[model samples]
Target: MAATIGTETGAVLVNPAARNRAAAGLRSIVLPLGLALFVLVAWQTYVTVANIPSVILPSPISIAKYIVARYDILLIHAIPTTVESAVGFLLALALGVLLAILITYSEVAREALYPNLVFFQLIPKIALAPLFIIWLGIGSTSRIAFSVFIAFFPVVIATTAGFLSVDKGILRLCRSLTATEWQVFTSVRFPSALPHIFSGMKIAITLAIIGVIIGEFITAQAGLGYLIIFATARADTEVSMAAIVVLCICGLLLYGLVAVAEMIANRFYSADSR
Candidate 1:
């Protein structure tokens, strides 16, 4: 009997590490997923239990069904907004990187413009969205310009930091080897700056989406923002919610794309996350 008891105790002790590892694996998966699942379940339950009108707050399932039913129309609106975001981001990338290079290369440029840049960043962008429409007219050009304005600052700040923060030792070695200014910048400074550029781009990408949507909200006839306005006027809550979901998905997709780009850059360049 004693021998049997000892065997059972040893078996229990031997399995504990395996049990712990299984528990950890389950936790790794479940912990993150659990919160989102809980939120969705709770949202559904609350709407059903309260007998809430769909006009007031449509259930998640209702919104999902509505999106499926109206996908053809939604796709029309989605394309314009996507185009605006992409164009704005591309412009921001070109201008922001150029500005960062200027600030790093020319002390005069930094001294003359950095203060104004900070002030420009501090001002509420939405308050000026209408002004942009007024100045540029109600078209894609104005919308793209507005979005670029919103995205440009983050890239400038982050990439400038990256350039400024490159290792002095590497810089000294470049100088010792009599590297040309362009060679030093291209080979050493730019590579070091990429991680920061990517960090800034991730932020700028999200801002670009918001800026494009805001520009559309200010003026436009054929985008997700316009769709929301039209639906709201008609008291079509389901359609409005469907448009909102599309906006959310678009934002997520943009951010994910930037993150993937960052990961790829990091892999190739061997960035040490500071």
Candidate 2:
């Protein structure tokens, strides 16, 4: 009877800890949402009180209404732009990682290519935008190329750093153990490099969006970038603001997706897992 009572008391104590953890998790989600709502309200109120002209700055309410009214139009352009960005970003990631691996394998290759990569990064991609347009025409291919150029640098540098930054001692030990080259890379270097690779990926993802938008700005028949230009030209500030808001939301969504991916990776492959 006494043991049964003790077990009940312990179970009761355990319940509150579990409940607290659940509540904390709930708060994590709710707090950010609440903060976003508060900021939106503040933005609308400020615009209203300041008597900001619709041509200069439309209120959140006005923008929201515009979004609702023109959802179909926005969807048509947004989808294609998003596809271009995604494709370009993935291409950049693949090429960057592959090059990084190759550079890691050969000191001569790294020495020869790294300087040229740096020079390429220094040359503004926009300066080449017109060239791409001429070469590829005002189409998806040109835009994707711009996106790849913008995103590729960071991924290449970050991934190369990740591979090179693997602890010397660990690498030496693997060598001493007569580990195969593949074994050394897979078992020691690759895992150690994942964080840096992910960091690069995050930067690349954001930059890829900007590149796509810039490409659209330069020459595109359709896209949010074109819509923004058109709306601004016509003084349709409501639609312009709505478009900007949608762009912001899209960027945030992409960043959030990366963050979630990182979290899942950490959960499964973290040091604790080993």
Tens digits of per-residue lDDT, candidate 1, 110-207, equal: 99979999999899987999999989999999999999999999999999999999999999999999999999999999999998999899989989
What TM-score would you give candidate 1 relative to the actual structure?
Answer: 0.90
Off by over 4 Å in 2: 1-39
User: What does the lDDT come to for candidate 2?
Assistant: 0.87
- Note the residue pairs that clash in candidate 1: none
**Top candidate, metric TM-score:** 1
The TM-score between candidate 2 and the true structure equals 0.83
User: Where does the lowest 10-residue lDDT sum fall in candidate 2?
Assistant: 265-274
Candidate 1 residue-wise lDDT at 103:
95
In candidate 2, how many Å is residue 226 off? 1.7
lDDT, residue 165, model 1: 99
**What is candidate 2's lDDT per residue for 1-274, written digit by digit as tens?**
9999897688668897886788799999999999999999998999999988888878888888889998999887787777788888899999999999989999999999999999999998777877878998989999999899889899999999999999999988998999999998888788888898899999999988998888888888888887888888899888877777788777787778878888887886578863
TM-score to true structure, per model:
0.90, 0.83
